[model samples]
Each structure stands twice: as structure tokens, then as C-alpha cells.
Target: MDFTQAVEIAKHIYWIGMYLENDPFQCHPYFIENGDESILIDPGSMLEFEAVVRKVNTISSMKNIKYIILHHQDPDLAAAVPEMEKLIDRSDLLVITHSRMVPLVKHYLIRSDYYEIDKHGHQLVSGDLHLQFVTTPYCHSPGAFVTYEPFTKTLFSGDIFGGIEESWEFFAGKDYFEKAKPFHAEYMPSRDIFNYALTKIEKLELEMIAPQHGSIIQKEKIAGLIEKMKALECGLYIEKEYKDRLIHTIEELKEKDLALRASMQEIKEKEELLFQKAKMADMGEMIANIAHQWRQPLALNNTLISILKEKNQQEALRSTELAEKLQEMENNIQYMSKTIDDFMHFFHPKKEKNLFLISEVVRHTLEITDPMLKKAGVSLTFEISSEEAVEGYMNEYMQVVISILHNAKDTLLHRKTKDPDISLRLYENGKDVVLDIGDNAGGVQQENIHRIFDPYFTTKHKSLGTGLGLYISKMIIEKNMDGTLSISNTQDGALFRITLPRQSKTGKTDATQPDH
Candidate 1:
């Protein structure tokens, strides 16, 4: 029911992160005791929070642990944050982690005091222990970082050197290099990310290696483990069959690259003209859209013309009533002219980066695509929780929104989901303004989820899809605007979330009511 003993893993560092007797994997969360201040590294998951707290209490008072070092925001390593915060009655308990992760980690912690370590590396002094927080993005998480204790010369490697085990042990054996190999390959993104992590560890003057999940490799074998890790292929790199295929892909890409070099100017103009190309694509998508666009106004204009024709044919085109009929026809013509203006305005790129209300952008997109969505028999609903402005290409932003709307409409009809509905929620999250677009169509198959953003990749039929919708959306958001566009499969269907940094309200787009 209690931790057996206080096993001093290093100078002032204790092995508080324990494994369950029934559980298969060993997740080691370490504790550093320096003066009245104590730092805990990777407090275990909510389920294991009690066990972790029980162990820590036996060694020292829970109130003294002033800081928590999180390598990454994994459930196994950091989900216990909320529970742990509830037990402690102190205010200085800053959760030491990454900056980009502050918002998400706080959502779980219920508190937001943090010292984010820079990706390059940052150091903080704790008594004699100089803690190094080295960021390793995409190793496992975008905000992943491992802590190093220079005082003990022990590197708490987080999940980097983690291994698989059927039993628990304090330190890793000489054969651990082989044991940990498979774990890294499966958990880490790729060798490119793995090698980036390796480079981080290789730079450290390490005497011992302590990982959260498996055994700790001692000083004598640290170099050997490093050497083994350097040589081992993990993740996609282990797929030897893909080697020739990858080479072939590279060769094909080289030919494409040579051709692309000639069109570098047009390539730079890649997405600026995306709207016109998609609208004019030989698929006649726009032709159908134009039909929808002109449907209402044209019908009214035709009715007015017919009224005039009937009166003239009957020889009753009197001067007393002719003015009203002419005025009615003029109003209908104006409506059609406005429709053409809206369509032209949407296709032109507003290349200037300026502050524009996100809600307006979203509303305008809805206006442009409303006719099409209605035609597709999909009910579209959107809620603007609050108004926030962002700096970017307003027209380009519209393209992204429209593309997503079209995607949802297509999926809803294509999947034939009952009572097809697409819901959009716009709100603020930390420093970013977020838009959540969810649908009631069947969710994407799990197999295709990961490759959803890959260029030239699509699930729709070849004729109906070029597969560039999501790829271009991702690029425009992430690369062009320094924002994030992510999607996940929901219970109802697919959920697309776009997060863009909210710009300062310095230069707002001049006041004008939304058109539609």
C-alpha cells in the first residue's frame, strides 16, 4: 500500500515515479530535493497520482515540492497535474515545461504558472543542481523537452531512451540498448526526429541516463547505449522494403523539382491564385456554383421581364403604371449586379497583411458557400463566441474556410449521413483565436487520418478530388500565416480546428457591416 523505501537515485534525486504491479510498462518520474525547494519530474497519470503522492509523502512533505518538470504533456507523465495541484496547498508550484504547451497544460493543471524552456536549451539553478531543459519538438510531442541535472551528471531522458520490460528494475542492463530500440521506433515520429533527439543527448556530458519508461543506463554503459541508438533504425527507417521505394520517390521528386524551378515565380504565387483555379477547374464545379449564385436574382429578374411582356402584349402598357414596373426590374438587375460583385471580390487576393475580424472572415465565407451548402442538403450552423482579429490575407483566409465548408458538404453527402449537419464554433484559446468545424457525416477511417494532410493524397474519387484541399489549407495556415490547422475524427464525423495567433488590435479593418 506504500512505497517500500526512499531510493536515492542520484544526489538529491529520488526515484518517485513508480510502476504498478499489474501494469506492464515502467514509467519513472524522478524527484530532486534541493534545500526547502523540491522539483518533481513527470508526475505520473491521474490513475497513478495517488501512488506517486503516497511515495513522495513518505520521503518529504508534499508542500515543499515547489516545482514540477514535465518532459512532455503525455497522460502517463503529466495527467496527474490537476490531482497533484489539489493536494498541495502552496502557490509557488510553477510547472516547469515548454512555452507552446503552456495553454494546454494549464487546461489540465487548472493553474498556469510555468517557466517555459526555449527549444535551443535553457538552464535554471536549484540549490547546487543546474537543471537543463532541452526542447526536442516532434520527438514525441510538438512541445517535448527533456531535463538534465548537471549536478548529478544524470540526464533524465524522459521518453527518449525508454525501453520495454516484463519486469521492473532500478537501472538498465548492458542489453537495454536492444530492449529500448523497438520502443523508440514505435513511439518517436521518425529517425529524423530521433536523430534530432540523439544529437541533443550526444551534446550532453552524460555519466548516467534515466528515462521515464524503462531502466536507467549507468555511467559505464551510457556511451555504448548512445552508440547503439545512433546505429539503430527506428520507426519508418526500419522499413527496409520502403528503401527502394523512397529512393524512387526521391528520383521522381527530383524531376518534379527541376520542372518546378522553372516556375518558381508561379510557385511563389502558389496559393494566391488557388481560388481562381479551383473556381475555374474544368470539373465545372463553378458552373454549378454560378447556377446557384444567380438562381434567386435571375428568377426575380425573369419574373419582372415576363410581367412587362404580358402587359405590352395585352396593349395595356399605360404610362400611369409603367414607372413602378420599370423600377421593380431595375431593383432585380441591381441584385444580380451585386451578386457578380461579391463573386469577383472573393476571388481576388487581398495580399496585404492587415487586422481583420475572424468572425467577419468566417461569416463572409459562409455567405459565399451558403448557396452550395444548401444545394448539398447539409444544414450549416456557426457560433461566434467572441470577436477577435488576426493579421493575414483575408481573401486567402476565406479560401481556407470555403474549402473546409466544401469538404464537409462533400463528406456529408458522400457518406449519406442522416440529417447531415455541419457546426462551427469560434472561440479564443490563450493567445490564439480558434475555429472548430465539426460535421455529422461518418468519421474518416482511422487508417486515412494520419495521411489527411499529405499533398496529392485523398480519399475521394480521382475525378472529384485533387487531394490538395487539406494540404494547401495546412500550408496556408502553418507556413504562410504562422498558425496551426489540425483535424481529428469525431464521434459524429471529422473535426477541423484552425488556431491562429490573435494580433494586436492596432490596425483594424475599417468598420463595415457583413454583406451576408
Candidate 2:
């Protein structure tokens, strides 16, 4: 496991990472010794330049290192590129990387010409080695990519699959994802983008994963680790963390609400009270949403604990196995904790406006409501005709969408509608972005249509319905977000439409309104 000198991983592949003991963030640079056609993949920064060169010298001469693969433009993995060029000292020594990375990587002031993978069919044949470049865009970096060696079936994944390990191990163990999760949650942009990258990696005939950071993963653990990474929530897709921040903000808002209540004479104070009440009413729905999110993780935790108990009874579990299961259970418990945190923040009051895609709002809303809809035997479909963004409090926008879907789900379940269906459509119309949510649980009665958005108006039994939902939703769309929420009857169902002014180039919504 010692990485003091170059260690041969696969035939000609060597781990030349300058390992600093007890360092939490480890950068791994690999060397492929293919004689005079040698390649160095992600040589570490200037701090480790001398030591890394010393290790590379032991494997092959600097002049023979013909290619240096700069996976992405990150300084730790790429800053030493110019210095390396001085050492290799060859005019023909090409820098291998994706085309999308060329502009940024060039800022490193690297003089060697790039062997752009995208331009050259993503393949390279050096001596006996056949190398392939796999583009993994937006997996943390827009130009992010990985390298694959056909002969060794080994991947040099830049930042993907990397971890921040407090207790460093040369090879990934069974509890590897536990170390990987925190890093992914902090770095990866979103589950969708990361999963997209993972789909490509899954198709590869991979025998090993050598990341820029953390331990190398062998074939035995590749599938399980990839599966875990796919499920990881990170960056802007960290809804749970977002909600936690919202709740923390809400606690401060609640203190202001108390002051507003004491001065009820002001018209704005009355409006604030109504908004606060509506937010409080949403707490119940948020708790239900949390339950849906927690279902899988809680089930996994139970299964893990049960297996440990059963193994103990049979006296078949080794201490190593016990420790691994414990770590898994801890991870599951942490995930559930985040869900609970999200639930507690269901009533966040809008404080600031920002630009966000309507598509992202719809996606996050479905994440909260899909389980409940499926449990009631309701089928939901969402279609996007445009990717228009709006400037607003995104969380409030998400709340409005969630409220509409909840209302649809409840109505479908209440009326015992056979083969219940809900459809969501998002599109750009003129200067506005429109979202239509329709459900086939029958149309609302004509007499009740106008009164539906009235505060404290409900048709359902006292315990099941809170009249505040639609009222708050209407308020959020019209008053808070400068949009409109309208309801109309379709041939077989009720359709709710939300129309918000599109984000303009000036960081504000367009003043022009959509035709009703």
C-alpha cells in the first residue's frame, strides 16, 4: 500500500502520487510507462512537482514521457503542466485532453500542443497502449472528462469517483462510498448530470477506477460504488440542505412575524400574517413529503440492522464485516436526517429573488410528490416544451408547484377515480413561462370554481383539507412572484396554469405580460 515510490498498478501503469501521511485531500497522479511513448495522467501541482518527477524518473526517463493527460483544468491536477513541459523538454510531446478543456487548460500557460480527444476521435495509440477519452461534462466541471485504457481496462477519472478520506487507504474498501458521499454531495452539480456521466462509465468494460483524489477502485467494487454515486445528491440538487437553510431563515422570519402581529394596524402587517399562516399550514404536507423521501433509506437501515442481528445469532459475522455494515447504517441514518431537516423547512418565507429554471422547480416538486401519487395508484406525466427560466424565490416557486400536485393527488384519491392521471406541461409562451398541471379526477363544480382560491375555503372534510393551500399558492404566484395562477376546466379534469414572466437579460423578469 506504500506510495512512497512509483507502484505498478496494471502492467505499465504506476501510482506516482506524492502521498502525504494523514492528509485528508490526496491528489493522485498516475504514470503509464510505455517506453519512449510514456504518458503521465494528471501530474500533481507544483508543490509535489519535484517529488512526482523523482518518482516518474524511477519508472521512465522524462524525455520519454510523450503525453501528459490533463483530465480537467483544476490546478491540483493541471498546474504543474507548464513545469512538466520544461522537464519533458520535447516539442512533439502532446497534452491529451477533451476539446472543451483546451481554452481553460491553456491558461496554465502550457506550451505543448494539445492532442484534442474530441477532434481526434477520442482515441490514442502509443506504443502498445490503446487509450480512450470519455467526456463527462458537468460532472463538477463543464469540460470534465476521464481516460480509459483498453488493454488494462483502467479509468483515470479526474474528479469523478474521487473522495475526501480522513483515513487514507491505497485501495477502496467496502466502505468506500461513505468516504465518497461527502465529497460528491459537496462537489457534483446534480444527481441528473452525475448519473448521466455514470451511465457512460457503466457501459465501459472497466477493471479499475483511478481517480484524481482518494483510493483506487478495483473491479470487484466498481458496480456498487457507481450505484451509490448515482443516488448521491449534490450542489444545487441538494434540496434537503436547501430546505434546512430555508428553515433557518424561517425561524428569523417568525421572530419578525411576532413584531408584525403586535402592530396589526398596518396593512402590510396583515398581509405578512396571512403569508405566515399559509406557510405554517404547509408544514403537514412537508412532513408527508419527508416520509416519502425517507422510505428507501429507512428500509435499507432496517435491513442492514436486521442482517447484523441475524448474523450475530448465527455467529457468522466477522468484525470487519460488522464495521462495514455499521458505516452503511450510519450513512443511511445521515440521509434520513437530511430528509427530516427538509421537512422542518416547509414554510420558508421568500426573502430574496434569484433566477431559476421552471424545469428544476417542476423536477424538485415531483421528487417530493411522486411517492404519494404512486401510492394512490395515480399516474403522472411531465412534458417540457421549453427551458425558460424565471427570476424569483425558487423555493417558493417549488412550494406553489407542490401545492397544486398535492391538491390533484388528494382529489383523485378522494373521488376514487379509476386509473387516475395527472399531467404537467411546461412551455414558453411569448415573454412568459407557463406551467400547466391537470388531473383527471373530474372538473370542479362551476359554482365552486371562483371561491377555490379564497382564504379558508375548503370542500373536503376538516381533517383532510386545508383551504390555505390554494389561497397561498395564488398569493405566491400573483403577489410574490409577479405571476398568475388560474384554474380552468378541461373536458375531463381541472387544469391549473401558472404563468410567470421570463427572466430578462437585466436580471429581472420581463415587464410584458402574457395573454390570458
Candidate 3:
């Protein structure tokens, strides 16, 4: 088909209205030649329609238009129908629309033979041309239809595919995609419905889409446009490509992961060191307890020895009696050595699972922390409610208690209250054993309360804290032992509650603390 042909038909049609110039609403009214007839699609505004009619009349004197198709009942397109009806004497078919749109079309332009297409996939024939009407409702208007010319492979898509712009070029150029994006965003806000319409039209093998408003879309860009419409149907935004941006995001994520891993390793090392330090501290406390235990015996032994020395000096002691005193002194020294040996064994790092008393763990923890509590001037209290043994990893449970008590002691020290106190309460609530540690220091800061257990988040002076104490304790109790650790603010200070399943339910206990 020649580009400047007045009337040509092979498998294509030509537009014969004013060039759109740049306005999407303003389109050149043109005629698409079929065989002996011409289909005038959206015959522009009334004035543009008259200009087209005059040009057609001047060219061939074929003023007898067979059919006037209206895709939508808009006045801009259908306004010229009434004017054309007066000019043509032949029985021109008025293919208005379905019954729903008849009244709307009648309100604007009257006096015509109206044919109603009210079904999906309806066809209308004129000589050698086949026009198929596909219902495209909810595209700017109800009862909107897009006409497909099968032989020419051209789809006369109305407002559905077109957009509002003021470009007057004949076809969508390289910049068409960019230009159409904003138009669809504004006019076609219902992407869901628009996608449905696109799907319906996808069945047809269309070569050209001459929308009523915008530029005609040619073969090269039609498929690209359809793909874009499909993307819109799936609720996707077309993103700009930036390799550097993607690389930066990946690098940042990698850096964060590396930092997290490093921080976690550091926390693990600190926890191991702390446990070692606690063990040493507990040994020191056990030695003190041993000294307290042997005080009376040692004093009696000293008294007996002094008497034996005086008797020997006075030359009045029997050999057997002297041997007996020596024997008694030897027994006391052996007993003291045995007591020290037992204390050392209790503090030794042993990997074993056994049922143990919760009170013992509490006592052991308090003994280890006694010096620190005294140094901080924080009085300590313990309330163990379960006389019946509740079991768990002895060392881990003790460590958890110690960590909480340590935090409490620090809090009290920081507040510098006159009557600084730390309290440990252990009790069984139903099937679970619970431990509550609280202090008389002011509770955690309101904003920092939730983040206290988060790794590396601390309110203490930076050098004074590693910030992993509570976090590591939580990991040990909750993740390793299937227990729960929570923190809440009390009137006087922050309280930490740990709940561990009792031995009766768990059936086994771990004596050795598990690394988490």
C-alpha cells in the first residue's frame, strides 16, 4: 500500500483525518478502505469529520458511506454520524452499539438505522472485509468495543490501548513506550480490568493498532506494547536498570552479614571467658566456705597440740597418750584435705546429664557473685520455693542466674540508691519451673527495655559492658534448653523471668552447659 494512496486495500487501511499534531484527544479523521466501501473509525471531532468528508467528496465523489462504526458512544467520534446520515442517500447501516448504550448514543446524535451488537465475539461483514467486535468494557467507558480486521491484521483499539498526548506523528516511534507509560497510569488506573482486556485481545494476531486518540502503532512496537500490557496485568512496575545500584545493595548486605558474624563470634568468646572467670570465682568462694567449715576443728586441734607440748615439757606425758593426741591431729588434717577435694570436684567442668536441685544452682551462683555484690554495695536475697528438686544443666542454669544477678548489681550500682538490693526468686508454676531475678535499681530505660536482649545493645558505659551478657544468657536458656527468657520493668528495677520445663516432663537433664 502506497503511503499517500487515497484508497488502498490489500491487508491494510489508511487514516484520512487531521494529523493529531500532539494532542491524543485530537486525532485526524480518516477513512480505512476495505473493498468498494470505507470504514470511518472515530471520525475525530465534528469539524474534523466535516473536513474529512469534504476531502473524500473532492477526491472521488463516492459520498455513499456503507457503514458508520462507533467503538464508543462518545460525542467526539459519534457526533459526525448524524451529519453523514443526511449526505448519504443509500441505506447506510448505523452500527451504534448494544441496547445499554442506545439511549446514550441517541441522546447525542439521532436519526439512523441502528444495529446493536450485544454479545462477545460478534462479527459484521461489508463486501470483502470482516470486522469483529470484541467487548472491552471498563476502558474509559462502558460498552466500549475494539474492531479487528482479520484480513489486514489491524485492530482498531479505541480508548483502551491509546493514551492522552499531543504528538501528531503517524506512528509510535522509539519513544512511544516512554510516552504511553504516564498516559496509562493516569487514564487507565484500573490495571486489573485493563489486563483482562489485553488478554482478550491477545488471541488475535494483530499487525497494527490504530487507537482513536494517539498515534497508530506499527508492526515493530506492537508486540512490545502487548508484553507491557501483560506485565501491567500481573501488577508489576517497569524498573530502571542500574548495575551499580544492584552491586552496591549486594555489597552492603554482605558487609552487614560479615559484621554480624564477627560480633557473634566476639560474644561467644566473651561468654567462654566469663564462664572461666565464674568458675575461678566459685572456687574462691568454695575455699571461703571450707575455711568457715573447718574453723572450730582447727582451733580445737591447736588447743590439743598446745596442751601436748606443755605436758611433754613438764615430763608427765605417757607415750600411748602422746601417740593418741598425734593420731587425733592427723585425722583432723585428713578430714580437712577430703573437704577441699570434694569442693574442687564440685567446681570441676564435667560433661554429664543428671537431675539436680534448683536451689543448689542458685546457691552456687550467689556464692560466685557474692564478692561483686558486696563490692557494688547491693544486698542480695534468695527465695527458693521448690523443696522438690527441679532439674537442668547445673552450670548453665547457674550461669543464667549469675548473668541476671550481675546485670541487677550493675543497675543498682549505677542508680547509687541507699538500699540497693538484688532478689532471686525460684518457684514452680504448674508444669514449668520459673526463676525471677529483680533489683532495687531503677528499671531499664523506657526506650531501651525492648532492645536489652538484642545482641550488642547496651545502656551501660561502653567499656564496662560487652552488651552480650543478656543476649547470650537468653540464647543459652531459650535456644539451647527450650526455655523462655523475658524482661520487664518493675517499680524498683528491671525483672528478668526465665521459665524452664521441669524434669518430669523433659525426662532428661543436661549437667554441662551447652554453647549456643
**Candidate 1 on 128-242: residue-level lDDT in tens?**
6688888788778888878888767888888888988877666788678767887987888777777888887888888788888888788888877877777776777767777
**Clash totals for all models, in order?**
2, 0, 10
Model 3 steric clash total: 10
Per-residue C-alpha lDDT of model 2 across residues 328-359, encoded as one tens digit per residue: 98988897886665555445545799988888
The sequence of per-residue lDDT tens digits that candidate 3 reaches over residues 315-431 is 989999999998999998887787776566566635555577776677766655565666567777777666435555666666677667767766677667778877778778887
Scanning candidate 3 in windows of ten residues, the lowest lDDT window is 507-516
Listed in order, each prediction's TM-score against the native is 0.47, 0.47, 0.42
lDDT of 2 at 283: 66
Every model: Cα RMSD to truth = 21.6, 28.5, 13.3
Q: Rate the local accuracy (lDDT) of all candidates.
A: 0.77, 0.85, 0.69
**Which has the better lDDT: candidate 2, or candidate 3?**
2
Q: In angstroms, how far off is 37's CA in candidate 1?
A: 1.6
Error of 3 at 464 (Å): 67
In candidate 2, what residue range of length 10 has the lowest lDDT sum? 507-516
